[model samples]
Target: MSLTKFIEEKEVRNLIDNYVDKPKFDLCAEIKANPQTKSYALVGTAFDYLMRFHFEYKYSIIDNCHWVAHNSLVYLLIDNFKLGIEPVKPIAFLTEMNFKDIYNDSILDVKDLQEKLKEKNDYKGRQIFKVINLILNAEKEYSNFLKSGNLTDGVIKATIDLAKIDVIYRRKHYPNDLGEYKEGNIQDLKQLYKIIPDFSKKKDSNILLNPTFDKASQLVGGADCDIIIDETLLDIKTTKSLRFTRKYFRQLIGYAILADISVNIKKPKNLGIYYSRFAKQFVFNSDIVYETDEYEILKDEFKKKANKIYG
Candidate 1:
């Protein structure tokens, strides 16, 4: 079980119900979505990727290159090679070409791709969209040259062909949802970029991208939080709904307790939900949300529950 699944367990829900309190915040004016927009999940994922890209371009931070698609590809490869299950045509073609070895080797090449992207010195929406696709495609098409003993020209041709198929495959199965991949999603990201505050201006702020709660994450199988600016942990939400639900509140509280127990950076002083559509953040001071005594008690209870459930 992952932290997400663990938190949804009945016992954990009961703990949250008993301890967590919803914070009050004024809602921002809504930025309506395009009528033709299909999948909010894709939009959310893309927006999250774009925000990470934006931060890298705007601030001084090392690229983490923590693409969630890598995990999806790993599982797909395992199913194909280990379990004797056939995947979609594009994926099947990849597996047939001994792409598993390429996939293993390409993990190290993400930094090279990041360097190439940095050389372009362009982080605009179109460039970002293309680069994001390239990264998601695993950046292993070049390995076809060595595998097939093909010349540069043949390798370039094969790479383009493979890339096209890969994009088609991803649009069908990425996030395991049905939706058309549209240019409007990129446009939405551009609009979101306009609203992002310049974190570089903040005094003595430290930014950790895709921060994980070390041992706490290990205990629950795996868990990663979004950007943490200074002492604030922010979860980006691309949902159309404006209401701050109890579900969201509990997720933040869960993360806070995990952070406290994990041997990572200092626990967040505040928890925030950044609603991307409205470009608004609803923040709650950690102290106000959980009093000192109550927070310690809850944290201890959480650790015991996590060990019993996932340890």
Candidate 2:
């Protein structure tokens, strides 16, 4: 399919609808290299609705600021810090910290910081996006003001928004709480998942591959992780049990194998599916964790059996 067609396809809905997910794995899975959705409201029927609506011919595309990836931004920050731009905003609590504090953190004297950075041998004076941090600080300030009272924009009140924040950090605890805990947590994990060791490799054989498993039959593409690489396909899912569902693990196993076949890297020896289960933390004993290699086999065995279903 053409790239545009793939983006607009309604069949994509089948992914979240059919796949299962419920529990969450706390480990920082690597980027393929490691990383880590479904809902059934009427929104689930959106694909059906869109098919019948004859919308206007596309005009200008929506203004989505597809800036650099978060990791890239972070890398730039680190580099800028070395250069003295120090774009890395200190870990300031938003709901707790005020505008004055943020301003101080950003820069007490911009000219002085700039001059010092200019003379430093840190980066040969490359331009940096020092402004983004300022914008984030501003966003945090606005978010904090909004949370000061139940009122929103002085016109509308957002029970849902408040509810989401309250769940993450109660009203008393949430400051500039733009769900930073979750985002910061993801950032903090980048180091923990520095390496993904212990996985096998496989080569692709077009002549030997079952024709039915061609690209046309491949339903999932980049649904998880920043980028899908060989030997590691990270998908986020929520499941009641974290145990192996090897009996019906063919599709995912195929993902690992397919990623291996297509990429030069090691066969994704691991398929990490992350899910969030609401079970109490006290019930830790009930949690199930399966090995990546074990799931790989479960997938191969299931594929052998499910081939009959397709036939």
* Top candidate (TM-score): 1
lDDT of 2 by residue, 1-311 (tens): 22112323343223212333323334432123122212221111211111111010111111111111222323333444532223344222222221211334544243454454466535323322333333344344334543452222211111112222322211122223332223332322222222222122323211111112234233332211212223234332223344434322323434444443343323444454432231111111111213333444543443443343333
lDDT of 1 by residue, 1-311 (tens): 66778788898888877776677766767665432366466557656655665565556644243445434443443443232223222222222322322444433233443454466555332233343454434334334433443333332332222233333333433332222245565465556656776655854457887777877777776677778887888998887777788778888888888787789657899898888777778888987545755766777888888889765
Best by lDDT: 1
Candidate 2 segments exceeding 4 Å error: 1-8, 11-234, 237-258, 269-272, 276-311
| lDDT (Cα, 0-100) at 12 in candidate 1 | 86
So what's the TM-score on candidate 2?
A: 0.23
